[model samples]
Target: MTALAVGCPYPPCTVPTRDLQPIRHSELRMDTHHRGRVLTLRRIAPVVKLTARSWTVTQESSSGGTERLEVILHRSNHGQDILESESMFMVKEPYYTLSDQGDPTLRIDHPSDLVVCTGSLGNDISCPSSGEPGGAVAATAFAAPVTNTAKECKDEGNAALKQRALPRALAKYTNGLQLVAKDTAANGSIACDLHRNRAYVNLLLNRLDEAKADGTASLTGIKDQEHQDLDAKAYFRTGHAAYNLGDFQEAKSLFEEQQRLAPSDRDAIAYLRKTEVRLHEQATGEYDFRKIRAGLSKTAPRADAASFDRNTEVKKSPGRGHGLFATRDMDVGEIVLCEKAFCVVWGHEDEALTVMTYDVRDDMIRGFPAGLCKAIVQKVLNNPSQIEKVMDLYGDYQGIGKHLIMRDSGPVIDTFKVHDIVARNAFGPGPVYSGGPRAEEDVRNASTGLWIRASYLNHSCVSNSKKEYVGDLMVLRAARPIGAGEEITHSYNESGDYDARTAALKTTWGFACTCALCLAEKADGTALRTKRRALELEADAWAEVEHAAKAKRISIVKARCLARSINDTYEDVRYNGLPRTALLRIRKWLTEATTRDLAGC
Candidate 1:
């Protein structure tokens, strides 16, 4: 028999604890003492077991863009239904060793208690069995500890609230929440206050899930009764958000509780009635939510997606080596592909490091929980080509990360490859940015992840596709229609002019722009260059158009003609649209010129 102190390396893995001890399986353990509680274990021969099942995949074009896919997994062959259908899972009755209605020894309490992983291509199925201690972590877990005082953060939030600066208020509340979680500056009341305030702000900002989470936190873990009134606010606002989000049952429960705590609140009464009406409507199927859904779809393009459309494939592209290409006509908002991340790092670290070392970046991958690290390592090792694919990204790993990255450390080569892949392709610690070259600011705030399928997208100033990150999953959606055999591309940056666009792309990704627009701009002769310079001037400098006239020493008349032409048809740039900005500037300049009686006008 052997006992060893070990970090848990199994399911229920989102928890970190220092007290866990791993024991040999052959040595069945007896009960242990913990604050005067007795713990027991039962045999597994009569207990439940899971078997590998069939996997299925479905594909469709995403409303938000990109080819989309949905995968369904099925499990069968248990003799009878284990648990009630209303619970989190439908286990066969024959497999039940416990019951939800009686003893919940091996059962889920309710359907609402269902836990699912929100990140891409992974399951939250890791749970380590250790008689040690444990604590929870969120999807956005980071290595940094909060340093600000809860009171200081709350006071700042109060100031922001006074100014109606909703975003600022949210930031302050979050800072306080982080401080509380890190145990650096918060007491129970401050924690409650932080959660309650953050819930209200989240409601105002229409972040329904975060509002619900904060509201739940505010109500729970309140050891003090002095702040029940604040808790009531959290309940009411959470209910309000639930109602708006169409969770009628949850809204009903939340509103009722709030009304009990604040008996004379009319808003709670109204909400209660509204929730009842909605519940009835839902039971009778009398509500057609399609219209609300349609309206949301119009505005929800900011963050949405899908993938797995076979109309696209990865293949060698001219000058670009490899790229994703469409094999058939695809409509806008169609999802083209879905990919799971290979390795992900939560935040950045600064140390005694050099630019070429990339050690901090490597730590991002190597720092994952032990079980997760093994799973990720095994995944790449299982497919050696995946490592090669990652290595083929942009810059040479040796040229940049050789000093430390390639050291004889275990999995060093694998970590270096993943880091290179993420450095070239990672997106989002925030919502999608249509702009180019993200992740340069404060690496501590950046989240780096690798998506093999998404890496196939090549650069285009006028890309036909865009990507969205749902956790570690990468979904590429079509920005516009595409014909068969067309290569899929996404802008490395938001739309910019020839010089700015090329410079940004070159500096960020080490690529030269040879697109049609670039070639056309290269043909600019002296007169055309003068027109372009005037066209590029800021709105306040509309008078600069006369500089074209000053060149070649011509009259204001010729200058006006050149200005009108330049303004009307600088046809080959990113911001071109109806009612061009240049034309608007020209109109302003023309009005001023006419008032001055310039012959050019």
Candidate 2:
């Protein structure tokens, strides 16, 4: 085989003759016109610089005579000096042959093809029977030949999957699977890829069970690393399905398995832990689903719990619809509803109710409930395996014991959940209230509670109904007449300023302030700013009078006049009803003034 180099104006200036090898017979036969083209040429001797437009090739003919070949050329767009001739010569022999017959007019057109030629003259050259590159031939050889009609279907399916058409991807995968059920090598990869994609689609549609099954199938026949990943995904999807179905134990187990397979998967770990906590709560009877149902059912009559029929009614907002409404006019002190919380999450503080000491029939005092109490105490002390799972889910119960101590010292509790709802509307400790004659009253009211149904009472800066706790029951008594269709609201904060209240509602509850009182408060704020200046002047004047009286310089008449002026300003500015702390300070100052004698001073 022989090889030669041809120069072109493009980069990598010299191209090899016959691509430095022989062209395949099949490839050559397919394009016969391109065969034997002088695709490349090399210099036989060092030559002087020649202009691109005019060049000469010197060759020794068979007769031993030196022949000079001149070719007229023109510059091409690609900067190549092209020959304008009907014939050209071989680089070595200089024998003229057909070169310009189909020579490309544009230099850039298929310049690569023009640069390299393949023929038997080049070393390591061979004619390919198949008209493809070696690697493509190898891949084709590895693939099994289609023996059945199903093979064509499978191929079509694969094409669809590659196109990212999910329905078609699934159809192809199923058809492919049906064609070769036991063949792991030929159809397995295609089937698995299709199933994986289907699982992704199912997940997007929130079909957890279908997603889990598809994920499982996708993992089949996969290698070690890929198999483990597929298994983790399968288990994770299974966990989610179980969680939505309220099978917390099953969900926890599946999630734990997923976490074991992929320890760095934070979402799996977090969700697994949450499921474990829920399971533990269920086992301990800490979460009462029945109570939640009862609460929601009882509140069904109130407008707060009304159900909207989506088929007939056009909803103005996503979750807005009339369901619960008053059936009849009810007076003050009437029973609106009686309901228990869906779930009561007793924070760690409720441990005080564990009954540590027992009053025995004998004179000696022993642990309460001897058996049950001991078990409860032991569970707390030893930290049960179930509790470990809960801890794994929510972290170790840090503030639980502290709450227990506070509960013993008369702390409060709060709880929430709704009935008829697939999931709890809320979940947390119930609120409690403590008050007594003694400054340090160490008696807790465990039975005094607020239920989840009470949560339906919307928030208000000034509420018409007052919430009163009477031993595990919350009574909502009307402080004023409630009109029909008006949302029942309660005060979330007893001591919050207008700004603080607005911020809390917006941040925590995701709502804008549209309440009547809120509007009035906004308007009052502007007026208050002006009144504040006058009130400050009056206060300053009273302070001066007080100082002069203490120094025995001002008369009692003048001091009284200043004090009266301050009081008048207080009433006008609404500071007369200031909080207890400010009121006490003013009273102390007034008492001192009355005690001192300023006769003629």
Candidate 3:
């Protein structure tokens, strides 16, 4: 609910200060203390002038009292302002309280409310800089004679590539291509090398379409009997682009061409084999899942070999956005779909990957692994072709226009949109284990990934389908028999009671679930609800001590009694065949206890 406390302060501002009119007013809510009261924040002050990013202003409140608002703007490296507004409003009347003690802080909660900076003083204000942004830089790079400029750009791009500065490297390579003439045979060698090298860089950056075009041009520019090795390299690069774009058959042909040019090229041979595997998986929805899982410890592709989606199709749902539906009848326990993650972050060894980020405006704290947001952004930047697949996903920042900041080197991405998208769509870092049950701490730091198609499967308390993760692959299976054209659903929050499930869904996904199970639980009498809560708590307590009791071979009657109590709470007609998540473990415990007692007799 406040500005970022961590950062290297900008070199002292020499620019003159002018009156700052509050250009925006973000609506506020304090969920912990407001009891669902939405407050509309209106600025009564005409203007406030300050020399720094942080300023304090006196404002007239709705209650006709003076309120002091302290606004601090933290300028991110991506050229967006993280606005922290702390308002201490005067209270004239008793407001309905959600807490016994009052909360003085007010917050703006959405990313769109935070201003996109042209030059750091929020939007609509520009900071003074020494040079014209991208134009001046580009002009200077091309000022030299065309041939000399081409050579200079090629050398600079190679150096940047070695340093792993991808965007800078891409800019240099592009500059070289602009100056080099492609028509003449005399310049063909230089042009060929430039296109081939640029294609390689594009492949590294995941700009597959650009890479494919450049690779094709590199091959075309080669005169007969000139650069046999270059031809092989060109084919290899183009093959990869096609492979990544899911054109496996074309990729196979390209790789075979590369092999014909250079039989001993190991990289080409390996990728050719991979292409064949992808072709096989594409034809039949089958894979060596065991091999894929075992390969998790080694460095491998972030995407799995194939996306098996033959059983489903995306179609419009009534109230919700597009949802995944079964295209054919599927039996219970049958695999419905298997897809690879678009991006994922998995912690190593004892590393706790989850990082907590404070959203000052929203007064919300969200946590994800440190590089997860950057990973997604970089993935999109590398392959601008896939930008729509990511941007089309549901987010809080929809309808907000361009946030990308143009820079001399390349476009500086605004990660706020990606951050919001990940928060809504990602799954993992818990309930995912490679082997046996892990400690709670290990489970908390597990792995997380975004599966675009999987996100389309909406939430339901008693879902028709269930999802499991293996490496980066998301495997969806029908929990109950699903008919043709049936919309598949999965429980978003399966661990909690009715209230907890509803609250989690509303807080995390921004929707109240009105599924059959949720509705039934809501209409359940108050007495029954109270009894169920008490019984669930008792079962939890028993679970905590069950392992220790089992080591001592203690009587299992309490486990049996707890299981019975849980089962009785769920009505037979309403909850039949639906997963009673609360009762599952208890029944297992009772079964184990009965087996042990019988063995002793």
Strongest candidate by TM-score: 3
Residues 180-264, candidate 2: write the lDDT tens digits.
5756457566666556656665554444456666766766644487777877877777677666535577778878888888899
Ranking by TM-score: 3, 1, 2
lDDT of each: 0.47, 0.38, 0.60
TM-score between model 3 and native: 0.69
Model 2 per-residue lDDT at 95: 21
Q: Candidate 1's error at 447, in angstroms? A: 4.5
- Model 3 alpha-carbon drift over 4 Å, by segment: 1-147, 155-171, 181-186, 221-226, 298-303, 348-370, 400-417, 429-446, 525-527, 543-556, 572-578, 593-601
Badly placed stretches (over 4 Å) of model 1 are 1-309, 338-420, 427-444, 468-475, 525-601
Off by over 4 Å in 2: 1-324, 347-452, 483-486, 526-601
Regarding TM-score, does 2 or 3 come out ahead?
3
CA shift of 353, model 3, Å: 7.1
How close is every model to the real structure, measured as TM-score?
Answer: 0.34, 0.25, 0.69
Tell me the TM-score of model 1: 0.34
Which candidate has the highest lDDT of all?
3
Which 10 consecutive residues of model 3 have the lowest summed lDDT? 8-17
Model 1 worst lDDT window (10 residues): 65-74
